[model samples]
Target: RLEPGGLTFTLADGAFGLGGARTPLDAPLRGRITVEGKDLEGLVAVAMGPEPRLGGGLKATFSLAGTAGRPVLTGEVALANVTVTETNPQCPEPRRRTLALPSVTLAAGWEDGRFTGRPLMASVAGGTVTATVIAQVDRRITVQLGDLAIRALPLERVLVDFLCHAQAVSGPLDLTGTAAFTAGDIPRTLSGAGQVKIGAGRIVGVQALRMLDAIASVAGAVGTLLGPGTPVSSSALAEFDSITGTYQARDGVLTSRDLVFNGRAVKATIAGQYNLASGALSFDVVAAVAGRNVRARVTGTAAAPSVSVVPASLLSPGDAGRIEKGLQDLLKRMR
Candidate 1:
């Protein structure tokens, strides 16, 4: 029926291209197989599964079979980044679906029987998403994330060069988490810790000031006026709160923070259990920004371990002035 797990024909002569050419999204397939790589070890194994369902018209499955020493094991599947728009003129700007991708030529690698380099070279909503991974091949597998790049690269790949320190500000945003399966369990238990490398890929100076609001007092303070002479409302100098929140997850854990918008720094954590058999998302996340101590309790499952933030402080107003000027000057060196 098939060659010794390498690549061969299955049934019809139309060349079904089973193993290597298939992806994880295409599950339980039975077709022809043929792969052309460097060596046999590099391409550990090949398989197919059901097409996974994401947010939009994202329908695709993935096939995995490789190790870190080998890199990639599966083949590339065709992807479509298409947007739908209604052509009617009078219908309130018509219905539009957006699909943004920055670069072309997308592919993935394999590390220890797991998939690597997924959702690469794509941009959406001004923020980027990508992953870096290192997986172990076994009956009970354990996978570790080298990095998770939100604004630049993928999350799994970023773990290699970054660390999970909640209070430090270096990289723009960092995501650190893990996945593991114990012995003799019906399913697997996946969970890990999270934190961020603050100020990594911020755009402007006001962004930095807002981040510090959670730990320190901002220099510029403005208020809104009324009765024909109200200050144009452009002045965002009012004191705000910090970002301190928590969450509990189901399939995994999810912790989120809205620090950049609130004019302050923040700290959030998401951790808990996720039952795949049941559709449940629970978590615990924390956020603290602008001298405001806060903890937001959430019950949603966002499976990845996250980055945490540490509190920051300055001595006095004079110290703040020096720090501010010095920080502005240091911007040249920080980024």
Candidate 2:
């Protein structure tokens, strides 16, 4: 029997269960609902299925209003134990594993075909991230990421997740950035700007530190003045105390400026452009050590970058000798 009800009628408030449902990704969804006339509320819980593309547990508390065709929703979404598997064919086996994300909290809303979220915060392995996001009906999205504080975050994890690299670098990372793009054309339409700072980190899997070690050895020979101990190992790891830089993205190319890295025995200033679409990298790095400047050109993909160091040069022979002597004297006192 069907009873006809008016356009407006208050719904009885009670607990209700919905099951055997699936989301757009075909993930299993189960929820409980409570309703009162135009105002409706529900708690939807999602379970990770066999989907390899996405796996995570999510719980959302949402309130809805208006008719079924045009409804407004406001809610807070929380994500836990989420893991996104790498799907790129070029990614190595070591980097193909799942990338785990820390728990996330989002204040979200949807109205008139537009979605918005603010104060989206996450607590990850070594730091905290907060951002704001907005997506319009036309499929354009904008994101603003605030200062993300990093403390002792594992370099391997960061590389695999963000840079799509399997190499390891250990350190604390601090950064802030913003990005905007249309979902219709992702790689080409993406644009962003950011500043990054890494403190007390080591770069592994590259011989970029060899020049530093050589300089240190030369300094050590002069008046028994020891340079910063050889932090570079045979396994190709270079240790650095700090790196700071600013970056901008336009037309799929990310350009870095005023990038500086302070190593144990050498200091480097880097300028480069990375192609977001092709993963190509071209960097001009100048390493200064023992009063000599060594220019290194780094080119290739992020997955396997190549570095070529030019011959070291002295700005002025007289000045170089004086500087070398001053450094030797300082090292002697430190000893």
Candidate 3:
């Protein structure tokens, strides 16, 4: 016992099974009910609110027998070395960033109103993020997630922890998915469908490959075709071996019709629409400049986008004045 609002209760190694009476819930119930806590940020701010701020240490276990009103709860719940700080709508004022979940688990079962977690593991960064939740809890608490798995996960920790954005890629990310949401608005009730594979990668600062190297440096060509010496550093931009994709998201709007970006002097193909909540961008790239095929069009909003070159009469005029002075010095060094 350690109440006072921080939570802690235990009732271990128990028993209670008497003369098959029949009634009084038919007497017969074993036990083990524990719930410890160290600092779960007030139960995760009473269930995910208060602007993402959850800390570590918490344990749970419930393994009771069937008896009291058909009681029977399986157990397992753990959270260690967890951390989450939030707010990085794309970074700036040190736009908060914490995210370091060394481990987490939740083997579940609860029947009735439902609540299953066949496996809900997590150990990000170093990778290993399984999933298979259910959570129905009637009256409104839907949360379905199936088979969704991601191995070797690590793509700059999913772009700086859940897409807060920041890239300099380095691969090892495999995925398989299925999702559903509404556990109190998970990013406007997420939706999903996926298949991604990336192993052996290197894409520095990707923003649709920096607007396809500023549309091949404003048509003056040889934007190093995306690779070729003199950039194995300086934040090397391309050096791929492969990248595969297949995705579909809903509410947050993400789509793809086949994305492929091979490297060692570029070779692209991408079709898309992205709008992870208003970062809007409508892609359509098909590269391989110099040897032929070169089509482009990337609309604005992943923090100022806009690339052209497709029947725009192969743009010229010193390639629109060096692509408007390299996009005003890349948005002035991204502000």
Candidate 4:
């Protein structure tokens, strides 16, 4: 109802707001909005297009002030039983699956064309996701994520269900990173640096593991003398005790120099670049076993990578010497 004091209106779902401005667009505005258990899907669609389908109940209490042209809003929003589904062709199968986020709470504000959500927290698959989001809407929308931390997040939920990637790794994942990307093209313009750790897992379809498996096949002659318990195998999967890495991404290219994969029988280090836009891989994997290194060059796309052991002719003098010494030691043990 419009009165001399201001305007007070009640929405369909018992949502209510009161504004204290003489004119609807005048300055010195004072308003408070309370919405309870409203459908989040409609709100999300209105704010962020209709691509990612969201389902949830949203509860919020916001204080609104400032002029119409540059309105300021501060609020606390809570979402319950949220499920989000979107298209991701990169996944192995069922390219679209719903991700259930049990709870999400945000301490947020908006001023002018910018939205800031500090300490946005979500509960996903028995883990916690925390991040600070800063989004600015101007000529093009830009989002900056700060203090992002994902603790013990399940790989199946993110990589398989959400991201839709063919590669499989099962474990609790811990990651801390900060990233900035454009709203429409995150894969093309994303830039970030982070450290990631996956605890006690089995990895398959990873290029490094593929290289290690190939190296074992090439050394099958030695494996025959070592007996059936030898680590040599053509199987493309590995049980890793832990995989830890620090990574940096710039303009859709990810580069790492010290990614270490620790397995019970073999350990490997990866150093190189992977192009996110084209899924091209250009990396070197060095698997260490019995104090010797089996080096391989990794190339091709992420979907189908090729690994070839680096010939002794391509190795440095020190690497060649180490390989030769390792062979001599193995022969002595056989005698």
Better of 2 and 4 by TM-score: 4
lDDT of 2 at 252: 79
- Model 4: weakest 10-residue lDDT segment is 9-18
lDDT of 2 at 6: 11
Q: Can you tell me which runs of candidate 3 are displaced by over 4 Å?
A: 1-28, 31-62, 65-67, 76-106, 118-128, 137-149, 153-178, 181-197, 201-239, 242-248, 251-262, 267-271, 274-282, 286-288, 291-309, 318-335
On residues 1-335, what C-alpha lDDT tens digit does candidate 3 reach at each position?
A: 55432768787887777677478776877889988888787677777677788888888898988776667789999888988787776665677777788889988888667889889999977889889899888788988899998888778666744554633466788889898877766656678888988877776555646754675464344334322433222223366776888988887677888988776666678898877667778888877654446687888888678887686544434656776787788899999
Q: Put down candidate 1 lDDT per residue, 140-234, tens digits, no spaces.
A: 54555444444533222222112221222223343333333332332434444444333323212232233334222222121111012222111
Off by over 4 Å in 4: 1-26, 42-50, 87-95, 205-215, 219-231, 234-237, 289-291, 313-335
Full-model lDDT for every candidate: 0.34, 0.59, 0.73, 0.75
Per-model TM against the reference: 0.30, 0.65, 0.34, 0.79
Candidate 1 lDDT score at position 177: 38
True-vs-predicted CA distance for residue 323, candidate 4, Å:
12
Instruction: Judge candidate 2 against the unseen true structure and give its global Cα lDDT, from 0 to 1.
Output: 0.59
TM-score of 4: 0.79
